[model samples]
Target: MTATPDIVPPTEVRMAEIVFPNHTNHMGTLFGGQALAWMDKAAFLAAARYSRRAVVTARSDQVDFKLPISVGQMVETVGRIVEVGRSSMKVEVELIAEDLHTGERKLCTRGHFVMIALDENHHPTAVPALPADIAGP
Candidate 1:
């Protein structure tokens, strides 16, 4: 009898970007749209990594901007798969801002994104179930 090797997939993805003048708004803080774009990209990468398949954003939910991220600050975005279905995954993404000189960090924004795995034909495709040990609510 042949045994199937257990393969654990990645559940999280992190990306970093430095806030620049062009990325800010008139108030000198990061723009809401730019933040959303970054969060979506992080979610896409996390879902793709977990599923090992092409993925697309299905929706974004409850994005809250808690703090202002000023220009010159470093932003670190993290995405983690929280829920998984046959063809979709819910990823929780957070953006943290850190002052380069002071090293002070704070959570600036948080949101949840739903991503759907897609096949070559652009139809929904099944994804592997998350490991029980790391599965989220």
Candidate 2:
């Protein structure tokens, strides 16, 4: 049997807020799809910051939600390049929701997203070497 490779740690962490009314379920919780959409966005931003090129999401691993995020929560999303190839990068993502009022935070979900950098012609393009600090960890 082929062994699954280990997931590498993130080289950087990016965070953003979960504004009110973003909680769509009427259960005082953010929607799962919304969380996913934002996580993917965050991953792309981090990858672009490191790669210095336009990047697109090629794949998103199954997302596992461990908790819910409510309105007024400060959601922090972190991404790391777990793997890199000629023109592709696999980023590990984690989302945490913090209750601003109580200062309580909960891990909402974790997943992996694969992104590919693109050239002006929209063709796959090579990514620059990860920053020395962002290299394989």
**Best-fitting candidate, measured by lDDT?**
1
Can you write out model 2's per-residue Cα lDDT over 1-137, one digit (the tens) per residue?
99999544345658787657855577868888788888898889877776678999999988898887777788899887877888888888999888788888778899999999899999999975555555566
Candidate 1 — which pairs collide?
none
Give the backbone clash total of model 2: 1
Which is the leading candidate under TM-score? Answer: 1
Residue pairs in candidate 2 whose N, alpha carbon or C atoms collide under 3 angstroms: 10-80
TM-score of 1: 0.94
After superposition, which runs of candidate 1 have C-alpha atoms over 4 Å from their true positions?
1-5
Per-prediction TM-score = 0.94, 0.81
lDDT of 2: 0.81
lDDT of 1: 0.97
Q: Tell me how far the alpha carbon of residue 99 in candidate 1 is from the true structure, in angstroms, after superposition.
A: 0.7
Candidate 1, 29-60: lDDT as tens digits: 99999999999999999999999999999999
Q: Candidate 2: where is the Cα deviation over 4 Å? A: 1-13, 131-137
